[model samples]
Target: MPMAAEEIEAMIRAAIPDAHVEITDLAGDGDHYAARVVSESFRGLPRPQQHRRVYDALGGRMGGVLHALQLTTATPDRGV
Candidate 1:
């Protein structure tokens, strides 16, 4: 099954309370998505680590509920 944008956003928010997340269904299918996230928690994290953190929030749902995710994580105006 595919995941909902709200669910994805909620997962991210749960992980990073201060994060601003925008989830989109890129393929018009719930499984494929793109998320642009801005968070204070990403302040000192690297790009790869930032992505991993978002994935971690999904809790292994990557290949199951979520098929593909194009993620962009940053900290306010600064890129993570």
Candidate 2:
């Protein structure tokens, strides 16, 4: 069974409380999703590490219930 968008979002939100996330359904199949996450926590993490943080948020569901995730992560800009 594919994961629900809400479930996916909730998992990530729980892990990164200060994140700003946008979830999009790529194929309407529930298995493929595109997520853009902006967080202050990403300030120093490298690309691979940033993605790894999100993958970790999924709690090892990447290859099982969640098939594919196209992600774009960055640090949110504060008023400057």
TM-score (all chains, Cα) for each model: 0.92, 0.93
Q: Give every collision pair in model 2.
A: none
Q: Write the per-residue lDDT of candidate 2 for residues 6-63, one digit (tens) a residue.
A: 9999999999998888899899999999999888998888989988999999999998
Q: Between which residue pairs do clashes occur in model 1?
A: none
lDDT of 2 at 3: 94
Q: lDDT value for candidate 2?
A: 0.90
Q: Which stretches of candidate 1 lie over 4 Å from their true place?
A: none
Q: RMSD of model 2, in Å?
A: 2.4
Off by over 4 Å in 2: 78-80
